[model samples]
Target: MAARTVSFGIGFRVGGSLSLLALLAACSEPLDLDMRGLMNGGFNTADAARASTAPRPAADNRGVISYPNYQVAVARRGDTLAALAARVGLPADELARYNGVQSGDTLRAGEIIALPRRVSEPSPATGATTTGPIRPSSQIDITTLANDAIERSAPTPAAQRPTPQVGTEPIRHQVERGETAFTISRLYNVSVRSLSEWNSLDSNFSVREGQYLLIPVVTQAPAPREVAPIEPGRGSPTPQPPSASQPLPTETPAAAAATTQAATAAAAAAPPVANVGTQTAASASNAAMAFPVQGSIIREYSKGRNDGIDIAASVGTTVKAAASGQVAAITRNTDGINILVIRHPDNLLTVYTHVDNITVAKGDAVSRGQSIAKVADFEPARVHFEVRKGFDSVDPMTYLR
Candidate 1:
């Protein structure tokens, strides 16, 4: 196909960040993306422009071109900022600021990164319009060129660039309110058919908030990155798992006390986990902690915000605790929402918010990676949660060893 070109102004929005469309401009091609930059210290964006020569907008269109809107993409394990940024013709520097990251960050696997929209403006000098990255007919598609550039200059995709063959079984994901099967599948790299069948969803797609489903991991291993935490956006992104298969009977009042004791002990002895750094106090051991969710972390927890890592789980996927702890608070707040708070022996509190239903209760303790509540198993669900030390929230990825 002929190269697509346009003219438009190129100026940063007064306060907001800008974007340059990278790939799959629209639904003609489905996008699978991840944004584990915050949690995994990775960065990747795809763009379609020559670094030195700026191009004009397509002959037909007129507005200034910038970044694309938040769209979907699948993240294979080891994907980095450079690879991702180049896929859609975006520069690494711009994406870093959007996700609160810098260079040398690896994009986390299994998380869905939402890309922002880019606007194109008309440039005055030539009295011509400025175009965003222009797509030209060439040896490689948008995704390949982006990955190549990153490897040459930044080295983000070197570790994990090759895409993996999708697994046979689509992991079951619980449906949360506000999540559609397509969105969940795109984030996890699973097909919509797989998601629908895994959850036994009907043609009409009837689903509750807390139901269980299966989804296979189509990407590589997961990456848990730690960054300087920022406050999570207050606006609840969208409207919004399962049966007790894993086995914990805290729904009843009788099991509360004993469970709490066991959970507290586990928390006290929280093993050390490794992130980009080690734990604060040598006395505290938090190594050997498993990722609560096997998938990638889409959005990480920020204090005075969700205060917990947001795992991009399918409607029926499992959500476990990062560290062992007792079920401290397990109920909804004034908003009529469901949440679970686990109190570890370390006096750290972990919260699982916006869940469909919880399996544990107050006084009941939990082990690391133990299932406490069903995530958005029914709808396109996100595990909204946090880790707090006594009353202060701390990054769980740091202590999750």
Candidate 2:
């Protein structure tokens, strides 16, 4: 009887252990995070499921959703366009018109309402990445030029105008997670060896996250100055007649002879400025394209990293077309930022991003310098401009006047 009892107890214990293990196995079945959409970019059953979810960025305290290319606000349950606009500090009618909805129309929860313009940037309080472009401290703020010009009515002479020159010092960069020495060097288009020497990196050239390193300096030659040649007769200044305010002297033989001699002497002397041409050159060159907006270039183009240049302007500044072309496409990125592409001759294309209030539609004919849109209201208020020849992007400065 004792042996039988011991056997029964062991069997019970084994059975209980098996039940527990089964429970654990059931609980450990892979969690359905619904992350398949992110893992695949192509359309499939997962994409349809993800679309129903309508995942969107969470709004901050200001009710603004911030993205690199654009921003949006999510609608709450039982909310109207007007209510959402008020919560986000935007005009109700403007918001409604931009989204193609009535002010009083009810919105579905989690529905995205694209912002016509940027409201604010992600704050540090939210723990969002607030990294900006790395620039040398010696770089001058370009807005100063506009401010100085506004303060004075007369245009400053080119010779007297202060030209902002880039300094030779290395730019300081804070290493972010996943950044390597080689990547940093590639970002600034400098050799890794120079970057290591400037920052005094160890033999391994390892950089830790949150560590600050100086970017290597690159010696760049000054661009050739474009001087509009003076035409042969155009350079000569025309003499003005005596003003009516001044009375002419009485006619006298001696005074007339003196005036004649003085006039002859002046004519014999070289003109204060020479007119080297009858008309300015109308021939087009590589630099025939006009700037999309009048602002300082905050960031220059890098082939892979930055495919275009960033020009910082006011929020409502007019953005003009770079060249005469037909509007090939007007679309939005994943972030809903407006992108305008114009198809020019020679199979070239010009792209304008971070702009709002688009005045032209797709397939519309646009002329050079035509107002196509306005700069978006971003924190820095900048426009991303690019010039593309076929599939590759080239230096915008090479073609910008």
Scored by TM-score, the top model is 2
Predicted structure 2: lDDT: 0.63
Candidate 1 whole-model C-alpha lDDT, 0 to 1: 0.47
TM-score (C-alpha) between model 2 and the true structure:
0.32
Each candidate structure's TM-score, on Cα atoms with residue i matched to residue i, is 0.29, 0.32
Tens-place lDDT per residue, model 1, 69-152, is 212333446777667666545676776555455535775553333334442322333133332222222211212332343234
- In model 2, residue pairs whose N, Cα or C atoms come closer than 3 Å (at least 3 residues apart or on different chains), thus clashing, are 230-276, 230-277, 231-275, 231-276, 231-277, 232-275, 232-276, 232-277, 235-275
Whole-model lDDT values for every prediction: 0.47, 0.63
Name model 1 segments beyond 4 Å from true. Answer: 1-289, 377-379
